[model samples]
Target: MKTMTRPRYRLAIAAVAAATALTACGGGSTGADGGLPSNVSFGGGASGAIYGVLATGMAEIVNTNLQGVNARAEATAGGLQNTRLVRDGELTFGLTDPRVVYPAVRASGEFADEPPAEDLRFVMNGYPSLYQVTALDPNIRSIGDLRGKRVCTAAGIQTAMLGELLTPYGLAVGDLSLSNLEWTECADRMKAGDIDVIGYAGGPGAAVLIQAFAGSPTAHIVGIDPDKATAMSAQFPWWKPSTLPAGTYDGQTAEVPTVEISGGTLVTRADTSEELVHQFLTALESHFDQFSKVHPLASYYSLPGTATNTMSDVLPTHPGAARFYRDKGIPGY
Candidate 1:
């Protein structure tokens, strides 16, 4: 993986999304008259990705169901930043990617030089993600095509994934004319034909790719070689087998075989109120249909699916969430 720097795109969610749904039964416990006295906040990914979108939906759901307990979503640089916020108790909850969450808790990988976040707690694990290599040029079709081409990505994590994506093709940073432009800048340059590929690692139907498709009606989503999927996963343990079904993106007529990543997670601090976590999970499960409607990528966030995917020997589920899963008979951490 290349040692690329993360970009600065820190913009807080200016306005809280208003909750529209009515509360369902079996929520959190309250004190004297109602819920908690003050408001709580949720941290999400950079504004454009699925994590940020889900965070906004979570806040709206919380505010809608539990009246006095206002919840807000904070837009962040993504999981690495959000995990620190949640671990330090700066955020009541956060939407994060497992790549960062696992390391933050264990102080491994990117966080090797830092102390482990002993306070981190799992809330919900969700959605399979992929390394979306979007290109405006029809000539660019696979990782091999990126050779000697100008490829751009912003964050270190995204760059690491990009490096891993290239390994099977026997490519490296020296094999291409690489650039470290911010994500938005990459998009702009790609549109201007200054960059051949704009790469990112996230769930399907990423907003940037959607806008790219709009900008270049015939823009293609360059896929990894299906034959190399297993070798790639073996070489990079974080990657898993993935496939982008036909119609995942507009104008995409055929399934694009790819690799899945270990990410798309919701986490909280260990000390956060169990009742609050419980209620949040309850609201999430009850109103999941509405959340799924917020973004096409959200279709991956089903209870059973998330439960089955979340459990790992490394990450631990929160006690509050564990109880919810146990009672519901969902087999997971």
Candidate 2:
């Protein structure tokens, strides 16, 4: 008979020991202990997408600040998926858009059973997303001019927000030939002359919008009337008046006023320890410049109560986060 494989048996035993150690350590592998809950996974948008980049930066910040906590970022579809994962405890944190958050909490929408995501608490708010309207027809200089044209507003939360924004202007889906297209599809359709107008809601520096504007020199960004924007804001409390500063995109010299909404919020489960959350916020505040270097958008992350323009939609601040805000006398929930 062949001699027993002593070396192989020893290797097998070592692997088992490692696995058991991981399981015994509160579902987290042994690493630097940051006085945090445990190892955490962050969920954001599609790979290399805006939210994906933001999530990656956040993970880096958290890992650097906390000991023993290995935070990893993962790519997901978008807001809706992120919210669901957080609710199911599949993710410790995530980045989400406000458009998706509102519907998720509403009684008539997909998250009716889940009700208000009471467990969902905000970590940070990102920049404003403008509703950009570009029309091929020279005569279509405003929202009213698209009455009889074929228009494409990318589907999902964006399409819904567009409908809400246009209703008071007496424009409805029936008023225009509508095409349900994604952002990339809408840009291509506009370039191919398949669509007369494209409505997009995104951050000021969306690549697709930049390309669309560059490709179609004749295309114009229809100006939204201030009164109309005000009326819409009255209907949707979350809507805010925002301006895309001059030169945000080529050939756009004058500041363009538009109805906007905040996107990209860092959220955590309600049960996450306050001490851990406090440490995370303190580290973020202390390292603002580091994150800003990582992503220009992160420049907005700072002390909550400062006079600098800041978003107020962060509804129920986490206890740990609230402590930091209160210490600064920043009004927060």
What is the clash count of model 1? 1
- lDDT, candidate 1, at 64: 89
| Candidate 2 lDDT by residue in tens digits, 11-37 | 346435533432333322122443466
Clashing pairs in 2: 32-67, 32-68, 33-67, 33-68, 34-67
Alpha-carbon runs more than 4 Å astray in model 2: 1-35, 303-314, 328-333
**Per-residue alpha-carbon lDDT of model 1 for 1-333, expressed as tens digits?**
223344343332322221111111111233554335356777776576667787888889889887678777676666777677667666777677766766787898888988798877777767778878888778887789888888888756777778888899898766877788766777777788787888887777776677667747768888887778889977766677788878877888998878887566777766666777787778878888887887776777666766653435466777778877777898544
TM-scores, all candidates, are 0.79, 0.81
Give the distance in Å from residue 190's predicted Cα in candidate 1 to where it truly belongs: 3.0
Q: What is the lDDT, from 0 to 100, of the residue 20 in candidate 2?
A: 44
* Candidate topping TM-score: 2
